[model samples]
Target: MAKLFEPFTIKNITLKNRIVMSPMCMFAVEKEDGIVTPFHVTHYESRAIGGTGLVMVEATAIEPRGRIRPSDLGIWSDDHIEGLKTLTDRIHAHEAHAAIQLGHAGIKAQTNDIPIAPFSEEGTVTAMTPHMIDQMIDQFKVAAIRARKAGFDIIEIHAAHGYLLNQFLSPLTNKRSDAYGGTREHRYQVVKKVIDAVKAVFHGPLFVRISADEYHEAGNTAEDFIYFSQEMKAQGVDLIDVSTGGVVNVPINVFPGYQVAHAEMIKRGADIATGAVGLITEAAHAEEILNNQRADLIFIGRELLRHPYWPKVASEALNVELEAPTPYKRGWN
Candidate 1:
């Protein structure tokens, strides 16, 4: 059997295949209230029906101000749970494990009020106060509870792409002189607390997405990520969803599987499972990564959007028979 189609288990959840529909913001919430809409239900369910092993909901904001956009999905209020539950039910009904990316956009958040970050950027962003830091950690904890109530199989903390958490992890963005800054361990203080808080309430497999490379001379280096990965492994994080860039906005040279090396490094350095992402659109490349023990999972992003039935396409390319949904079996065969 092709490695791409092989079942992989993490904790109690077993993915029928290694293909993860990486979290990408849909910005489809029309009301700007941070609630999931019918579009979200249909969007995620389609990928599930298309044979994705894990359908991860987009980067969902933990609070209103945390939203990357006004229309981003929110988990701050209890009212958001019902809609999220409905969406997860549909994905599970299609035999795909449902996951949600819990995130806070921070200085990257597009809102009327000032955005928050690890350090103040004068007119650009507001530095987080100690009280605000405590509040943010609680927000992550509360968001994890809502994810459980929403019936998600896995909860991924979005610390990548220069979002709130990534802001703390990167030196280019975080210049705080307090305990949350200075040393690498100090820079990791907030992320560590967030992980601990979430794990206290969440018992299932937990994942953290991190920008392994910031694409700048002074940004966090590979060694820095290795250390961070080891810390996360010690904190009971099940998987490190490895990604790169978006930390300092420097230009990145994109190519197929460009970020896979970081995933492989973290896996080997930290001795933990990792999911490889970024421009991995081909089945053979994904198989090579898994077969060679470079990464544990393949996270498909833009390609999944271009081809919802990408798993089926990959199965065929890898010469494996993927069972389609009952109604589509005849045509799929």
Candidate 2:
């Protein structure tokens, strides 16, 4: 079997291949009510048809207020179940395992708002109190229940990109001198609570995405992620989806695979399953990452968005035949 086309299993789920569609926020849902639309369905279904082994839904808000933008998809209530169910069933019909990335926005809650960049703007962020933290945990638990009901095979908690959980994990953003801040263990408490709550409600596998390093002058380092990964594994986290930067302003001058070192560190330091994402476009590059045992999975973001049939093209380029959906045989070029 081709290295990238080989099957691999994580807990109770088995991925037909290693090529996974990285979670990309499409902001396709209609209205501010966070309703899933046909656009959302078609976006993911197309990826499934393109032969991705595991199709992860975009960064879904676990709470309505956690929405990054007005049109982002969400799973905060029971009403979202039907639409998500439709999307999951459609992806599965194409023979791909469906996964959902659930998360809260935290300090970076509304960073995507163009007019008022939270980093530069003041008075927009509502400091999350201890009670609010508990409420956030409950929201994640309920959202996981909804995702499981929606037919998702795996659930990944979005902890990267300086999102809610990431904010708490980063000392730079989390200035709260309380239990949810100060020390590394305390900062991690918020996500740990959310994880415990979700595991109680959902029996399937759980994955956590993390910014191995904030990639800033005053950000968490690779050593920080190694410790976080160790704690995550101890808390029953199945995989660490490693990505970097985003805590502060990004320097566009950084070279490609600059973040891959974070993935390599987490895998080696923690000896757990890790995924290397960011600018991973070529087949040889992806295969080499896996072959080198740097990361167990490779998540393609912008590249997959530019080419929904990337998995198909990658298969052909790698001399591997990906299983195309039956009805699309004529267009399998």
How does residue 267 of candidate 2 score in lDDT? 92
Reference-based lDDT, residue 30, model 1: 92
User: Which portions of model 2 show Cα errors greater than 4 Å?
Assistant: 111-122
Give the TM-score of each candidate. Answer: 0.99, 0.94
RMSD of 1: 0.8
Q: Per-residue lDDT tens digits of candidate 2, residues 1-333?
A: 667888879988999888888888887776776778999889999988888889999999977678887688889888899999999999999889999999766565553542211122357546666777787889898999999999999999998887878888888787777777888888889888988998998888789999887657677877777888998899888999988767777774455666787788899999899888888889888898889988888888888889998988889888987666788887884
- The candidate scoring highest on TM-score is 1
